[model samples]
Target: MKRIYLLLTTFSLLLLQACNSFFDQMPDDQLTLDLVFQSKQYSEEFLAHAYSYVRDEADRKGGVPFDPLSDDFDVPYSESPAYPLNIGNWNAASGNYNFWQDYYRGIRQATYFILHIDENRELQGMAGGPQLIKQYKAEARFLRAFFYFNLLRQYGPVILIGDEIIESDLDGNDPKMNLPRTPYDACVDYIVSELDLAATDLPLHFTAQSERDYGRATKIACMAVKSRLLLYAASPQFNGNTEYVDVVNPDGTPLFNTQYNATKWERAAKAAKDLIDLDILGLYKVAGDDGNIDPYRSYRDIFLTPWNNEVLFARKSSDLGWPYEKHTAPRPIGGWPSYSITQQLVDAYETASGKRIDEPGTDYVENGFSQADGTYTEAGTYMMYVNREPRFYVTVLYNGSYYPSRVNGDQRMEFFRTGSSGRDGARDYPHTGYIVGKNISPNSDVRNSQFISRPYVLYRYAEVLLSYVEALNESSPGHPDIATYLNAIRERAGLPGVPQSLGQSEMRERIRHERRIELAIENLRWSDTRRWKIADQTDGGEFWGMNTGAGTSLHDPAYYQRTVFERRVFRKEYYLFPIPQSEMDRNSNLVQNPGW
Candidate 1:
């Protein structure tokens, strides 16, 4: 096994060299391939490292930032400074390159393993020998599928490179070296097949190796991914478009000869149903006295709990360890103060009855909540409404909600006095006002400075259930089963079930709305918007904040005037991120996506 690890490490080094010329001059002291594949342990470790590449921070940086580029919700001016360029404009030349490179890096490692693992006949002598090789291949395929899915989501029609491409082939000397974009359908087919291959070998759950392999890929994870990819492919954005009929094969013939088949929807439904039948995963239901349930509690807990059967796959990080939480948490009291949940996102939450605050008979002025809609009531004071939906309380932190430290359970309510002095004494403290809620751990013993590693869940059981319901609705429109699925989600969230009187369109709207609130800030919104073709909804806008300083003067305009253009609204061209110009320049065979 050690030999195999050395071989893989050596191969990875070679691949790294291939990535840039810097490593090319290094000595060939690295272990030979012959020495590495001799043992199963070594092979497994190599594959695990390859898996680690999928969730690496470098890969996450590009993808995670791109998430807000969708329509489900918007971030205020406060969060805009994080990535001013990408959020302010649809342009993502540098960001896309980063994403493309990281995905291909993982893909290359996977291809190397698939191409080599079978040749070693010595594997027959090891425990699980050929089966182990097959399993590893399956895992690699799964990772490949995941990367491809991400690429397709961002770039739309991308060049599909299944195997490692030799530099010589793309020396600008070979005609076949330059490949044009694959049709959207072709790319989807490739991803679907890869997931199918992966599902055949991965276990539904990890039972053999406990803690170490807990969050690794599994059969169910592969299925969840496939179901998600196919549903997106079949959506209006790609499948419903007739212009792409021969986009890849402009010669009056289909390049991949793929069609926008309705059967794809059925296939997605079946995949989702298969996962449900596995019975190992299901909705995290929280029942209410009046049968009004709130799914938010279950959803919130899913992120905090490790080895949760609900989480299919996740990127492990400590509690305060995740840089996102560390940076976003209130600084001085916490870490690098960054991304904050905006007032816009907070206001989107509905009351326990699933009604918006502005709805008729909602008692807006009496509740002290100002209606941003601008319709003034007789009451001079804006009511601060409370006790709406259970989820409203579970996920949001309003004016008076407790602001506990993510590390220690220390409450910031007292320390955040209105008259606190500024760090420089010349100006007042910026964050000495309100704090957000939900993501922070309420454990009082743990301080905000403590580093706690909590795994970042990529796919969880709640999503599995939601995906099943979504696929079922799309595949069988108006199917009676829609209510069953929709109600399950609502009931879990302490909300009333959808009335049977609602039409198909209304139900679909409700489902879309539910998904938006249910999955907000978990990093699914960006792709969700792309697949739904709603990028135009994210017009760049200012992030707002309240003025809380040393003075008690509420009339000062500067206190409420701080705003930043953190989000760029969506334009049609923003639907599919432009293919990096660098890649287009190097490969003549590459064609730019439409509207680039």
Candidate 2:
């Protein structure tokens, strides 16, 4: 635990002002270096520009490709870049979601801010005095380290341009400008150390600051990144990955550590436990008048309720909620309805009693309609949807599901052939019968062009708990703390805990399953599958969905049956993204990912 501070408000204000200020600069009358950094406002605006590079996780269409790239969700249009990406129809030269240049530019901007902000005499005389300078510099460091973490996640080992800034007058042919990628473990170590340094100056929480400062970098956020990054480093994809041994620089310098490191898992477990031991965060819960946990409301409102206890980091100000809801809402209610959830994700939800539907004695009835209302859904709901966990109803928009987004009132959504949201020529519709129901605000009325804005949650306490248990299970199986944390998530979701009798391998599968259900559609599965080296098993080949091609009604046998909607291709090289070929042409020291 470290002392926390608040400085994110300046960032949001800077974002709004950059468009009219820095972005509006012209060559003839552009603000010079001294002119920009001399004034406190301009200096703050420049610092905020570094925050602008944060990923638009809300943009499922392109900004965040992980959601659609995974098996959990589908995008209908072939014209969308993700469509070609899913089918393995593109390459490094195709220029698909190439953020390599964009993120590095962000890193440079942060570095520039850190190097120049002290020139502002006005900032030195501000309310907090010179201590504000240290906080601002730490903030810039967080953003720089954060950008490097993303680059490493997507491109494996990226060129780590440390404190030395590449001078603008430097030639493109200079070896300084065309550096080789750092080794994988070194990259991980550098990122974690940077985050630790940033945390010392950041606040543990933003409660004492203005509400606008809520999303700023905190000690908690730094710890969250450290936890996740170490978990990835410990996983099979990077740890002892023999396939990437040849992924070396031009000088025969290995960019990836080929030897297995068992201690990486121990380091990961310690990082997660460090966060949990703080005891400041808990699973978001809602209790009814009966004083029992209302799992349905608890689960649904985690996204709907802004700034809840479960949230660690979120985007406080964004225009993406409207478009995200518009894409996910029913087509009849002015939505594209193309952001559909796969049947595999639909099947991932457990029964109310915490049993998998395929397991014996789980009592999953595939053919019949519900006889009565269960905990999550209504009477006469399809048997496939009835008796499922509260998270299922909150996450899936099925054929007869009710959507409150209609102008008139709540509408029972239909996805049958004759239904309003169903197939009509080549128009956009869910290839799967279900739409993504997670993170969609219930108050949104897309038909009337109305929506309730909500924060895009980037990290939550549940994930921290799960990460701790996962890493702990890997490092030391049957630890008493494993069941303690794992059951907290399950209990919040209105389910039972795992039996302590289970062995290491059994607990491993259970943890993975819980992650799929708890963190579903949050853009985590793509990396999870890749890091675990299970993407080929889970991401490739025939993807199934309810027959959206046929079906006159909800109960029609032709409509409800599982059908193959798309065939995807996943190769070993797909585990890590290819370094853009343009980058290869410019930097002879760089090596492309294997099989690219």
Instruction: Give me the candidate number with maximum TM-score.
Output: 2
Candidate 1 wrongly placed segments (more than 4 Å): 1-29, 56-63, 71-82, 86-92, 163-170, 207-209, 242-262, 285-297, 317-320, 363-385, 413-436, 443-448, 539-567
Q: What is the C-alpha lDDT profile of model 1 across 318-373, one tens digit per residue?
A: 22344444433443354333234455455566765677667786532223344343
Worst 10 residues of 2 by lDDT: 1-10
State the lDDT of candidate 2 residue by residue for 1-596, as single tens digits.
Answer: 01000122123323333233332222212456677667776666666667777776877776677888999999887877789989999899999889898798788878877887788888887888477777778888888999999998898999898887776557789989689889989999999999999889888865544675667788888898899999999999989988888878888989888899889999999998998888888889999789999988898889888988888877665544566888877765677777889999999889888999899898677777887777667777778888888899888999888874535367677777777788865466888888888888767778777677666788888898889898889899999998989998999889999987689999999999999999998989999999999999999999998888887876776788899999999988899899999999988788888888
Q: TM-score for candidate 2, please give it.
A: 0.94
Model 2 residue 206 lDDT?
55
Model 2, C-alpha of 525: deviation from truth (Å): 0.3
* TM-scores of all candidate predictions against the true structure: 0.80, 0.94
Number of backbone collisions per candidate: 50, 5
lDDT of each model, Cα atoms only?
0.56, 0.82
Instruction: Assess the local accuracy of residue 512 in candidate 2 as a C-alpha lDDT between 0 and 100.
Output: 95
In angstroms, the error of model 2 at 230 is 0.9
